[model samples]
Target: MVAVRIAKETGLAIDRVTFKSSLTLDKATLKAVPAGQCVTRVTLEATVYGDVTEEQVTELGEKVHVCCPVAAIFRHLPGCEFEPVWTLAKAE
Candidate 1:
């Protein structure tokens, strides 16, 4: 949502945005030990489709990170790591 809004605001010609998520949790937590943060790491791959350049995608990704509230929450949590990967694709 944030990406689309930014694209519209900036006139980036973005047609759509898609993402995939992968998460890792502490082994102890998985074992039901309850001794550490449940989520240890998060990886999000965001693909923006439309007429865009690598620099544009990179800039968009940075802006999204700064604007995304959910990402902010994960960033503030202790022992939790968040990684966001942004890329561009030709609009079909």
Candidate 2:
């Protein structure tokens, strides 16, 4: 799992980014799913200080999710669920 935060001014300048990823299993079930072989989810928190619209951010995120390598990998998995959480804060 990874979390990213984007604090941008009216000009949309990213300020900070935080991310993390890990793997877990049910002890004996470790054989079914090897360590470091799964990606739970990725979350992106962005705060924009501009006139950016929600549609724009959502569209961009959709595009990224489709091409994101990690997401694509999990897409083909049997029980892997891929989700991208986006939090956009628009400045006045």
Clashes in model 1: which pairs?
Answer: none
Candidate 1 C-alpha error for residue 8, in Å: 1.0
Weakest ten-residue segment in model 2 by summed lDDT: 1-10
C-alpha positional error of residue 45 in candidate 1 after TM-score superposition, expressed in Å: 0.1
- What TM-scores do the predictions have? 0.87, 0.50
Q: Write the per-residue lDDT of candidate 1 for residues 1-92, one digit (tens) a residue.
A: 99999999988988899999888888766777543467889899999998889899999999999989978877876788999999998545
Segments in model 2 whose C-alpha atoms lie over 4 Å from true places = 1-28, 36-51, 90-92
What is candidate 2's CA lDDT for residue 69?
69
